[model samples]
Target: MKKIMFTGGGSAGHVTANLALIPYFRQENWSIHYIGSVSGIERKLIEELPDVRYWPISTGKLRRYLDWNNVKDPFKVVGGLLQAYRIIRKEKPNVVFSKGGFVSVPVVIGAWLNRVPVLIHESDMTPGLANRIALPFASGICTTFPETTKSTTPGKSRYIGPVIRDELLQGKAERGRELCGFRRDKPVLLIMGGSLGARRINEAIRKQLSPLTSRFQIVHLCGKGGVETKLESNNYRQFEYVNDELPHLLASADMVISRAGSNSIFEFLALRKPMLLIPLTKGQSRGDQILNAESFRKLGYAEVLPEEQLTPDSLLERTMDLYGNRERYKETMKAFDPGNGIKQIRDWITTIMK
Candidate 1:
């Protein structure tokens, strides 16, 4: 069997697209190996897969800010590079697939130095610092949006859209209703703020829960350590996190309230779910979420409510607006093509290996 090494992870976003390709690669009978930070969310997630081998390496986050860690991280990056280089030399995988994160930088460099081809995927409108650093080493880069093409090396990049999990579209609304304990009267509103929930959005939802629950039942995916048992209503259900039930919850919902992460927004677009997006501000991120939201709004797939205006009133008002304009939003999403990039991506992986 041929061999492939996958490297990506600072967050679940970096790993999920790779996950979408895993089962397909398994069916094709390839030896799969993953290189990631020893303690990253990626190791926890990828370790659960039955057939893949996981390799841990040192990694330091790439921060754009003036962080104290800046003094120490370069050494870690160097250490990671050495570890990755050793792994690549030993494994001799035919190709390396990266999903663009700090951990990916060392792996990409190691693969390139070892005479292996690298394929990178960037899910954001703008390339993260890690991907920018790794670009010179990659053989090709796949992007989630057309706008991202201009940000990459001209000929090396292509707009292939996102790799959405097939199971997401298989969701059953009846199953969702049963899980959320819905009585079938009010519409369901699913609120998610990435893998780790957004405190601002969570607070706004709880503060306006009384009024909001009157019109719609809520299925809140409030990341780990975010559940609140003190405030409970029959119309509102809160879970710290979700995995299997996510598709059903998404399918059952009339609309979404979310952060503007590219992977998530594209998933919502694929499901034709109208969204009220509250993007992360500059203080929190490099403003990619803001750009992602603006693009979605411009495309008529969603409405944006800036973080500065994330009060209970604003959130509820925007949600009401999303609900009112849902059909128009759904129509826009229906017309969108996030591309069947998974097949193309899989083909590229095997072809590159060959």
Candidate 2:
């Protein structure tokens, strides 16, 4: 049996992409193993799935600036790499795939050192630092945007779009409404700040609650650390997280207010939902999300809001504007969707084995 090891973590962005690969991997009878940090949010989601083994690694964050915290990162990385190496040796996988994140570095490095063919799927328009360093060593690199190819050397990179779950590709709107107990008579708006949640976006929405609730029925997936208080009106349902019923909520929505994470963008595109995207900028990866937002906005797919400009008034205005011009917004984004990527990814992997 062909064996493969996968690594990525931190948010649902990383975890969802990994989930996209599992069904296809299993059908081919490939033995699969996962390597992620013990404390990563992804652990809880994928742990119960059978035939998949999860390995924990000691992960450390790499600060973008010079700081005392930088001193301890190398040690942590070394330890994680050692743990990854042990898992790789024991599993003896034929290949390794990584969705770039801090948790993935050690696994990527371990696979490279062991001479295993390693492939990386990068989800942002601007590749992360770990991805930038790992690209030259990876046997193949897949990205979600055309602009991303410029960051890496040619011949090794290809654009495969974002990897999204199968349910989003099918119709999700009707089911989303049913699951949330929302009425289809009114417009449904989805507010998401990734899996862990975004404080700024949540706060802005909170400030505008009175006006927003009056106009729309909303489903807010606030990050785990978000304020979980109700708006006390009949128009909204708040959750620290929602895992099982995303397709319904996304498909049933008239509009979405979300972060410009690559994974989130693909979800909107798959469902063809009009969106107002707020890219992270405050100590958020040195304009990484800013680049993702800019790329999509340039294509007329979504409106981009920088962190400094994301106030209640700004969000409300943009929300109303997009809601008013729904036809033009939908027309402008006709070419942005890249159908479900699972079959494409599955084909690519099987080709390698052949």
Candidate 3:
């Protein structure tokens, strides 16, 4: 059996995507092991998978600033490199796949130095700093957006679209609506801020709850670590997080309002749900969210709302416009092919092993 190692962590989306590809690997009878940081959300999720062994490594942020903490980052990176070297030497995998986050950086470097074949998947229009830094050493780079091609180093890139799990592909939308207690004839609204949840988005939703709940049933995913629903109503259903139920909720929604995180945006695209995007604006994350949202909007797939001007009233108006013109959005989704990306990645792994 070929030994395959996978590295990526930080968020549920990336971790779940890694887990989703497990069946494909198993069917081919490959021996698979996962490596991630003990600090990330992967620790909680990866422990549940059967027959998959996991190892932990210390990782550090590649801060984009020149500050006191930035001085400490290199030390963290060095320590992580040492840890990753030990992992690669012990496991001796034929290939390593990365989902592109800060934690994956040291593993990428270690794998490359050890002559391990590395494949990277960057799920955004603008690749993350970790992936960009790892690009020069990657044997192959897979992207979810066509626009991402420009951001990568030339000669080692492919466009395979988004890799959505089977659940989202075959899930019943109407069943999700019913589960949320939504009317069969009326449309449903789905709001997600990602695994950690978005406080600002939740706040806006709270303000608009009265009006939104009146016409549409709402499925809101509050960030697991953030605020809970303060308002209670029959038309609104809330979850701290949805690991298994995401597909049902995505399938059931007529429209979605969310932050333009790369993973969440692609999930909407896979479901072909019309969306209004509110990109993140605060903190150290910078303008990457806005860039991704704008790129998708330019493709006519979704509408962009920079957080500066994203008020509850404006959001409501934009959502109403999409609701009134649902046919156009449906047509947009029909033009997209959501399958085969993950399969392509799986095939590439098999080819490399041979």
The top-ranked prediction according to TM-score is 1
Which digits, one per residue and each the tens of the lDDT, describe model 3 over residues 1-354? 788888888877667568778777878788888888877888777777776888888877777767787878788878888888888988889999988778888998888888898998888777888888998878988888887887788878888887877777777887788677777877788888878888878888888888888788888888775545556567888887876677777888889988887777877887778898988874537578888888888878898877788788987788788777767877887887776888899887767642
Clashing pairs in 1: none
For model 1, residues 257-318, the per-residue Cα lDDT tens digits are 99999999999999999999999998999999999999988888889999997788888888
lDDT of 2 by residue, 1-354 (tens): 899888888777877788888877888898889999888876777786789988988998867888886999889999999999888888888888888888888898888888887888888887888887777768877878877888887888878877878766666677788766788798888899988788888888889988888788989998785756646445888878876677767778898988888888877876677888898884776677888788878777888778789888998989998888777768877766675566666666656531
- Which TM-score value belongs to model 3? 0.93
> Alpha carbon lDDT of residue 161, candidate 1?
86
Better of 1 and 2 by lDDT: 1
Q: Please list the C-alpha lDDT of all candidates, in the order they appear.
A: 0.90, 0.81, 0.81
Among these predictions, the greatest lDDT belongs to: 1
Worst 10 residues of 2 by lDDT: 345-354
**TM-score of model number 1:** 0.97
TM-score ranking from best to worst? 1, 2, 3
| Candidate 1 stretches greater than 4 Å from native | none
Ten contiguous residues minimizing lDDT sum, candidate 1: 345-354
